[model samples]
Target: MAKEKKYESELLITRIFSAPRELVWKAWTEPERVMRWWGPKYFTSPICKIDFRVGGSYHFCMQSPEGEDFWSTGVYLEIIPLEKIVCTDSFADENGNVVPATYYDMEEDFPLELELTITFEDHNGNTKMVLQHIGIPEGITQELTKQGWNESFDKLAEILE
Candidate 1:
């Protein structure tokens, strides 16, 4: 008998939005819509470009309250319209070139590439979205990522309203 492999994931976040699943999906895949709510509180995405197909990429800059800019880029690995999205996310420059997590000068080691999977399901007339992020290193705390997601989702909800 073959032994089963237990897959370990670092973070999981779930949000139930008061909107249709398709609308929620649009908010994630459309650049115009994403600009409205892609960052956390006090952070604005001044630049966003999304080519939302398999192997396509999305890049954006999240501006801090103090006017500092941080960039993130992702390449889509799978996309199921209105249902699921899987992508590899990484810190990057304005040109979308990969950057090491050490650039952030954090104490812990944050993985340069992290796989994020999101699924959208219909909850009656609303939408239930689940986001799972894998490959976070042990030295890095999950709270930081969780807080960022929670804050970003709060912004997303406002746009969905």
Candidate 2:
């Protein structure tokens, strides 16, 4: 039997957008705007189902440029309109069943889900967005996951632009 791995970490990413807070908030709360820039540059989210309320569920499918598909689902734990959202994010099947999410090619020990909290603050005409990703695997794999997230965020900036 393989030894079980114990790993934990958290990631914080902050960005300032030159847009009104309400518009920036809408880009995240609205499914259509979300789908436009939710994944990496080479990936596109063709399907997104969102319910903007606490206890609601959101499901989406990201298609890679090469035709590969990945599904993600989450349950909203808390929601403050145009302010903050807290949820659990996880990999899922096409039917929205939670499954193991392979991070950085790690075949074991990675958490099946992550608790994410996102906040949007209005700073004059700029929107300050903060994303907190908790439950990250430790060691070198954490770096890879971080990189992936940065890339995804870059895509989001483009979508918002």
Instruction: Write the residue-wise lDDT of candidate 1 on 1-161 in tens digits.
Output: 10111123468899999999989999998888888887788898899989888999999888989998889998999998889999988889888998976666654356677888999999978999999988654433577778888999999998899
Give per-residue CA lDDT, model 2, range 16-98, as digits (tens).
87778888888878899988877777788899999878998999888889887888889999998889999988888888888
- Model 1 spans > 4 angstroms off: 1-8, 138-140
The Cα RMSD in angstroms, rounded to one decimal, for candidate 2 relative to the true structure is 3.5
Q: For every model shown, what is its TM-score relative to the native structure?
A: 0.90, 0.87
Clashes of each: 0, 0
Lowest summed lDDT window (length 10), candidate 1: 1-10
Q: TM-score for candidate 2, please give it.
A: 0.87
**For model 1, what is the C-alpha lDDT against the true structure?**
0.84
